[model samples]
Target: MFRTQQSRSGNDLRFSLLILPGLRRAGMVVRLLMCSVLLLALTALSGKFGEAQAAGSTAGKHRAASSGAKGRHRSVRKKAALPAKARTPARGRRHGRAAAVVAGATAATAAAAVAASPAAPAKAITTNTKPELLPRCGFTEASRRHIFSRGVYVLDEETNTPLFERNADTVAPIASVTKLMTAIVWLDQKSLPMANRLEVTEDDLDNLKFTHSRLNVGASLSRADMLHIALMSSENRAAAAMSRDYPGGRPAFIAAMNARAQALGMPHTHFENATGLSPENVSTPRELAELVKAANRYQLIRNDSLDKQKIINIGRGQLQYINSNRLIRYGQVNATVQKTGFINESGHNMVLRLLVHDRRPVIVTMLGSGTADGSRLDGVRIAKWLNCSLN
Candidate 1:
């Protein structure tokens, strides 16, 4: 019975060992499954936590983007609400404001940006000033009414003020009216003897314009007689001889003529020759008005200029030369000093210092009259106008 028991025990022990190994293996497999279960639970928990974190981050980003958009919208609305004039900033200021607005600024920040911007320049305001009233005589309109000369200057001798004028400052050839200047210059010389006889030679002839002359070469006349005939008849040869007999000759005489013009304040007057034959002898009516006043100072000029007719001695016989100015003969006007000039280029020109209605001293200087008798007609019209207006 003991041997059987021992053998059974050994078999039992073998079985037990085998069963133990199996048990151990079963336990290990169960433990491994539990560990796997634990690891799966932890992983599920970690995944849930990560998903929550991602959702929170997305919500924050949305909030930030919405805040930025709302800020920009508010800024635009506020800017739009401003007045039309205020919203449009000046050139330089607008550029700065635009740069600040582009930089993702808030409404309050944009307002500050605009406030910090530079001020624009102010606009200028103009004020109206009253104009001056020109001097007017009662006869202003009447003076212009009857005058037909292309250039006319009427002056009040008492005041030496201009009464009426048309192209008065225009420079034009004065033609034989230049004799007035010649007569003035000749008489100005204190040393030259007026009674001294000056001979008319070939040099006295008008070679430039080839104008007709009644005074022949080799004829002799006193300086006073030459001047008288020159002024009265507009004798070309007599004027030439007067210039030739000047102390320093024609060139000196011409220089004196210009000097005398300047002294008389004739800014636009210029003389190229002694006689008026050259078209270069030019003056403005404004200047000639002053010249007429100056010429009227001399008694001889005033007398000779208005003389109806003058008797001049030729080579052997006396020749009577009528005044070129018809007004001196025909007109009822009492002219103190009168000079007439004519050329194809200058038209008809005249300068008259006359007493209107035997009371007022008026000077009428007309240039570029239409016809040969046009200037005389103008003079008569002016006199009639003055008489009617002054009375």
Candidate 2:
């Protein structure tokens, strides 16, 4: 019985030793599998975190570029909000099986390192767009009719009745159109001989606006020639020279201009300078229409104003001065009296005394036209309207 018990104890000891090593091997394999699974999970999580961080970084960059200061603060805050572990490299935990686990961890660490790497930055996009256009000068009313000029007046000369009016009472700068009044004042003083030669002086140069003139200082022209160019070509220097050559000079000539305006019942007319270079030379369309009527009565004024071109002596050579009133020069209307004027302050302006059907007379005045063509078109439109009204 004792011998049998000893043999059984030896067998049991040998079996226990064999089974213990096998159980250790199984536990090692299970530990290696657990480590591999944990590493893969960590690697995947790191990759996901990296993707999120890349997305945040790209968005933050866009925001920073879009907004100046506030977006920069938001980007800094987003980077700072990430957990310390997520921001740094993910490392695998050590186990009892050193060599096997180290190999797996090394592979996982390499993969996680690759996964956590920052992605390429996103590109910014831009768009090309066209520039805005300038605002047009005219406006359309409820009646659907557009008037380019700011002020307009049409009058029947025989009946002295307003045929059409648009802001006619608004007083504005008349510009070189003031030359018409200057011509009227000049013709009234018949004693000043038209044959008398007047020399342009430094006083005739436009000091107020510093405007250039072809008729230079020391240039001479007869009173009739001076008057001709002044009305036909809006010759500022010629008008100024005529004023300087008047019986009492420019001051007296200017006074006579105002006096004549008053005599013609133009209560709103005022002449500051003969050249109309001064913005103070102002008159309303209604008053200017009346002035155009008075100017038409003077045969000399009518003839000079209607002339398309006049040859004048300028000391060097004879230069032809063309009429500034395109409506009359182009024969667009039977304009008995016509004048056109412009200055920065006055814009484009025109006055016309038109002979209509049955020897009847019509006076049209346009002020503050946005362009030269605007004034001319205004005249054409009024003439057409008059023709339609008569029919």
| Candidate 1 whole-model C-alpha lDDT, 0 to 1 | 0.81
Structural RMSD, model 2:
21.7
What lDDT tens digits, residue by residue, belong to model 1 across residues 113-222? 87565432212101121111110222333344555689988787876656567898999999988999999999998888888788889998888878888788888788
Q: If scored against the real structure, what TM-score would every candidate get? A: 0.63, 0.62
Q: Rate the local accuracy (lDDT) of all candidates.
A: 0.81, 0.80
Predicted structure 2: lDDT: 0.80
Off by over 4 Å in 1: 1-146
Q: In model 2, which range of ten residues has the least summed lDDT?
A: 129-138
Give every collision pair in model 2.
Answer: none
Error of 1 at 54 (Å): 99
| Backbone atom clashes (below 3 Å) for every candidate | 0, 0
CA RMSD of all predictions: 25.3, 21.7
Query: What is residue 205's positional error in candidate 1, in angstroms?
Result: 1.0
